[model samples]
Target: MRLRYLLLTLGIVVLGLLSRKTSICSIDFVRMYVGDVLWAMMVYFGCRLLFVSLKKSASFGVALSFSYLIEVSQLYHAPWIDSIRATTLGGLVLGFGFLWSDIACYTVGVTLGFWVDSLPGWGRK
Candidate 1:
């Protein structure tokens, strides 16, 4: 079960990275939004991996909070944090700016996570 969540998280990370490539996705809207969606999905799966005993709702709550927090954190632009955001990994994880659409994407992603987590064989412990 833990392995499943870990693999799902990693797979989502790959997809999120691929979403940024114009050649791979082709669609402008998809390229713009899919990364944020997959980012939230990865967060949910990561939460599930770390808190294996948590109920689906609890896991969703944690993931949603974390995703939103990260998004909100973009509003703060201190030199130290900006320098971190200048790095490749930091740019990917922290992002450059805040978008209202990203919040919607996150909601969809976390809700999708909840739906997936409720599936019988897919989510069963």
Candidate 2:
């Protein structure tokens, strides 16, 4: 269980990084959406691993809420926050702007996480 979620989280993070670094095959749409979606997925996986007793629905809800909090945080732009956003890691995590589209992406990602967790043997102890 732990190994499965760990690999999934690593894979999603790698894909998210590739989405930002590579512009392959008209995948710019993916470049736009993948980050936020996989961010939620990664969070879901991490949450599941950490809180092993939690239900999938609960984990998904927590991940979605965290994603929304980060998205909403974009509305604030203090100099310190802006400085943090200027860094690649911070920018990727905190984001620079808010978009309604990102909310949809997060929902989709968390839903995917929920579905994936529902698979046989996935959430089993």
Candidate 3:
């Protein structure tokens, strides 16, 4: 179960870096955060699916919170990491910088996570 979460987190972090780098989309802060949030939600769902024993809502909550933590980590300056984020495809996956709106995104993502998981015959044990 823990491994599932870790893998999902790793995948998301990679994707965030990619998005941050190759984003042809306008860096409209809101849009960026929303995309970030949605991706986080997907990661949450993926994580839950990877490990089936965890409850639906609980997995969503955990994923959302962990996603928030990663967003927060962007505030720190990691030169090598920033370079990597700027260069590699993983950079597009990993996020950069801070945005308060990301919290809203996290909330929406979690909600979406719940909704998706609740789909009949989808994520159930």
Candidate 4:
């Protein structure tokens, strides 16, 4: 189960990276929104991987809260944090700006994660 989540998180990361490429996802809307959606999904899977015993509801809540926190953190700008955001990883994890749409995307992603987790057989130990 942990391995499944690890692979799913890695796959989502790759897809999120690919979503940034114009050649792969030419639509500006998709390029912008899909990455955020995938980011949330990755967060959900990461929670599952780290906390295998967490209930689906708890996992969803934690993932959603963490995603929102990361998005909200973007509103703060300081040289120390900005320098961190300047790096490739920091840019990806912290993001550059806030968007209400990203919040909506996160809701969708976390909801989808919950739905996926609820599927039969997937929940069994």
Residue lDDT tens for model 3, 33-118: 65666577666867675657878767776887777887777787778878867865644456667778777787787787678667
Clash pairs detected, candidate 1:
none
The sequence of per-residue lDDT tens digits that candidate 2 reaches over residues 1-125 is 88988999999998888877664535778878888788888988988888888877788888999989999999999999999999988998999998999999999998888888888876653
Query: Which run of 10 residues does model 2 get worst, by summed lDDT?
Result: 19-28
Query: What lDDT would candidate 4 get against the real structure?
Result: 0.91
Inter-residue clash pairs, candidate 4: none
- Model 1, residue 70: distance off in Å is 0.6
Write model 4 residue lDDT over 1-125, tens digit each, in one string.
88889998999999999999998888999897988898999999999999888888999999999999999999999999999999999999999999999999999998887888789898533
C-alpha lDDT values of all predictions: 0.90, 0.86, 0.67, 0.91
Pairwise lDDT winner, candidates 1 and 4:
4
Ranked candidates (TM-score, high to low): 4, 1, 2, 3
Q: Which candidate is the best by lDDT?
A: 4
Model 1: lDDT to the true structure: 0.90
Flag regions of model 2 displaced more than 4 Å: 23-25
Per-model TM-score on C-alpha atoms: 0.95, 0.91, 0.67, 0.96
